[model samples]
Target: MGFDTATTTLLRAILDEVCESISRHETGVRAHVASKILEAATKGEKTPDGLKQIGRAALSEAPTMWR
Candidate 1:
């Protein structure tokens, strides 16, 4: 399912915030964070704070090798 512009923008912002400490080269970690946020959104988590929390959790759960 596709998201509207606003939702997309919000998700992107949250991804950036959550991945800020992560290197851009760490595609695995970034993809992991993005997928988790998208998963949460698909499950009806549209709020910024909620999505951010999910993103943060995903980041923390990312492969240790990537971190």
Candidate 2:
């Protein structure tokens, strides 16, 4: 399912914030975070705060090459 422009914008903003919070520069890491955020968004997580929480939790759980 496709998201509206506002939802897309919000998701992008949330993704950016997550990446920044995690200091994720590697493409793989960024993509993983983005996917997590998108998954949350698709699951009806529209609020930025909620999305951020989900994204952060996912990031914390995700296995990383560098810790």
Top candidate on lDDT is: 1
True lDDT of residue 67, candidate 2: 38
Per-prediction TM-score: 0.95, 0.80
Candidate 2, residues 1-67: lDDT per residue as tens digits? 8999998998888878877856655767777778888887888878889999988876787676833
Candidate maximizing TM-score? 1
RMSD in Å for all candidates: 0.7, 1.9
Q: TM-score of model 1 relative to the true fold?
A: 0.95
Residues 1-67, candidate 1: write the lDDT tens digits. Answer: 9999998999999999999998999999999999999999999999999988999999999999876
Query: What's the residue-level lDDT of 30 in candidate 1?
Result: 98
lDDT measured at residue 26 in model 1 versus the true structure, 0 to 100: 95
What's model 2's overall lDDT?
0.79
**lDDT of model 1 at position 43:** 91
